[model samples]
Target: MNNRYSSNSAGVFTWFRDAAEQGNAYAQFNLALLYKRGKGVQRDDKVAFVWMREAAKQGIAFAQNHLGAMYYNGTGTPPDDSEAVYWFRKSAKQGDASAQQNLGLMYRKGRGVPQSDEMALTWFCRAAEQGVASAQSLLGEAYAQGLGTKRNFPLALAWFRKAALQGDATAQLNLGLMYRRGHGVLQSDTQAVAWYRQAAAQGLAAAQRHLGVAYAEGRGVQVDLERACSWLRRAADQGDVDAQFNMGVMLSNGYGTRKDEAQAFAWYHRAAAAGHMLAQYNLGGMYAHGRGVQRDPAQALVWYRKAADQGAPNAQFNVGVIYANGHGVPKDEARAVAWYRHAAEQGDASAQNNLGVMYANGQGVPQDDAEAVRWYRRAAEQGHPLAQYNLGGMYASGRGVERDPVLSYMWISLAAEAGDETACNNRKLIERKLTREEIGSAQALTRRWRDAHRA
Candidate 1:
């Protein structure tokens, strides 16, 4: 219920005071509203509470609802959940839709009553049936998630449509998602875009970000990088981390805008501060390569470690490189080995190759040709040119298994095709040791391997 009151007529305050003195409930409620808003009266929560209490005691449903809100929020009196619940229950039983919705929220959150999805659903149904838009939205969500009811996509769609038609931003967003995912509706990018536009116009940040991505990817609309940037900026201004990251990428790559590395760095830093893993990794790159800031190995390591701690394989590999190369820290081959192992276990080919080199040289691990061959094979299967060359050398020298010239030739030839200069030179030397028929067999094996592993 709106509590705004105007003292436009002359002597209105005096008239209200006289009526309230004579026990007029409307006059008391109106006077309380005026006092609460400081309209032609001194703002005094205590006075407002006293007058509101008098009106509520006289069975004024609106006043009782307001009293409950005031108690719940500690606006006029100390917060008392029980008292708020009592007033809300009284007003709700009298068909006050707002009170009923509020009571439902309280039950859903267990604020003043035991948490009961059934009670929440019952109250929400009552308010929704009375055409309360927010209650309709909540009821739709409950149906969609099967909270206190069977999951019913059709009912959810119906309730969401009702609330969306009433201009509820959240309902519009949810409706857009349903259309996009084909939940209880035919998948239609056009329909999703329409609903997203409604919520985006209402200043919903998530809707703005989703619309930006749709425009960028040409999913629900024609590709429009300028429009995508505009929408992304709007969401980024509202502190949306994904939007901030996207903005950084667009600015850095000069996508539909002039390249602004400094601005991109700022956006990336903002997202990184919010704990975005990719943002942290990119921030480390910027520091390491001096992309938009001065090169600082120490800062690079700091950001890389942050991303690494979050299980970023690339960051872990970079961390290993940094320690192995002694960039802004003491060189520690053992620490490098540990970091490389972490990334290699996650299937990072570069880390696998590096681990193979470490094992072969016995820098941070026991000198074991078998362990080196194991790591090299893992990386080679993933098409790592360096690991293929290393594995070929191991086979030629019989360092791990018995020397096999045909296998060595095939592996080195594969590495040479990948533009490894060392492998190309090594392949020419190994060719002199093989017969013509052996070379033909190795060439055929290479073709079969390439076809089988094509990705």
Candidate 2:
């Protein structure tokens, strides 16, 4: 068939129908786009695919990429991850940045292909180096989390900066966290606010929440509770749980706005219902304390259980306390210890200390001095004051550790100055026995440990 001139799109199709039938690749691709998008024709994905297949076979990169996107997104095609991957690979091999990024996403999520972080990284790096903004942001996250490469904060920051400079909202938010936390750059709250604002203006809910916190805390900007609440409400409207939870906290605490327990309760309930674990814990506290509503211990227990089941540290600790004290449920020391142990393994200092006491007293598990010291020491290293005090006493009495009077005096002296009366008393007793050289060595150890953790 010979190519024919046409005046309008419909007229072009009449001419193109013949050309497409005769396998003119350009005509086939044009007709396919029309069919695929339902422009000037009844929508027919099957027919569109047929024409696209013909055009793609003729080395049409755009057609191949479009077809791949369709398959990847399950638009006008049966959902087939493997088929999507095959099409994406075909287009990506032709240096299509979008295809490369999409292929990386597929590999990263294990969608329609075996999970391969390295493969994902390869594709993402290729597209990012090609200046694809989304790919740059995705690679930044992968690097930050050490998903496919060695943890390299500087490299992550570099990728985030590239994407953020290109106006990528997610990258802007990520850069904000990196800068604010001093992850790969100097801590700069001012810089964090700048990035957060850029993303927030783009209606990114996560950024809105972060911006609200900055305003509330007066970190990089003036503290304006009203502005913080406004931003938080905007994010909450978008169903961001962190925003919702923080907003409730502000309301309850009377920060920026008049205190309103009822309104706080409502926001906490909504966020808790949305499966926000922290909100669940907060909601439980409100219910248990009868702050916003009528006292309902059962309701409190329900919310606490929700958070506790998800392994929230504070929630687990609180739930254990509630059980032990018979606040909402029957006094069950056994249940309390179980909850404490769960949180303790996750390195919750309070839980570790409490569990140690439970073991030392034979409250839930069998009493074992060794277990008590083990749990207490774990908490003490993290600076849980009570655990530090308890550990020092155990050392002095040789209850859990080897009875080395010098070491005992050394630990007691450290805890005593940190305000543990038991340790202070023990230190006084040891002072009578230790020589000046041993005392000097213990003081030096404390100085070194303190210096190492100063900031």
Among these predicted structures, which one has the highest lDDT?
Answer: 1
Compared with the true structure, what per-residue lDDT tens digits does model 1 show for residues 1-455?
23233435325666787899899999999888877887776789989999999999999999999999999999889998888989999999999999999888888888888898888999999999999999999999999889888988899999999999999999998899889999899999889989999999999998999999889999889999999999999999999999999999999999868899999999999999999999999999999999999999999999999999999999999999999999988999999999999999999999999999999999788888998999999999999999999999999999986899999999999999999999999999999989999999999999998999997
lDDT of candidate 2 over 132-251, digit per residue (tens): 999999999999999888988999999999999999999999999999999999999999999999999999999999999999999899999999999999999899998999989999
**Cand. 1 TM to true fold:** 0.84
* 10 residues in a row with least lDDT, candidate 2: 1-10
User: How many backbone clashes can be found in candidate 2?
Assistant: 0
The TM-scores, one per candidate, come to 0.84, 0.73
Cα displacement (angstroms), candidate 2, residue 53, comes to 3.9
lDDT of 1 at 122: 93
- Runs of candidate 1 with Cα error greater than 4 angstroms are 1-32, 42-95, 103-123, 145-152, 363-371, 399-402
Model 2 segments beyond 4 Å from truth? 1-22, 35-38, 41-51, 152-154, 325-330, 343-455
| Leading candidate by TM-score | 1
Q: How many backbone clashes does every candidate have?
A: 0, 0
* Model 1 poorest 10 in a row by lDDT: 1-10
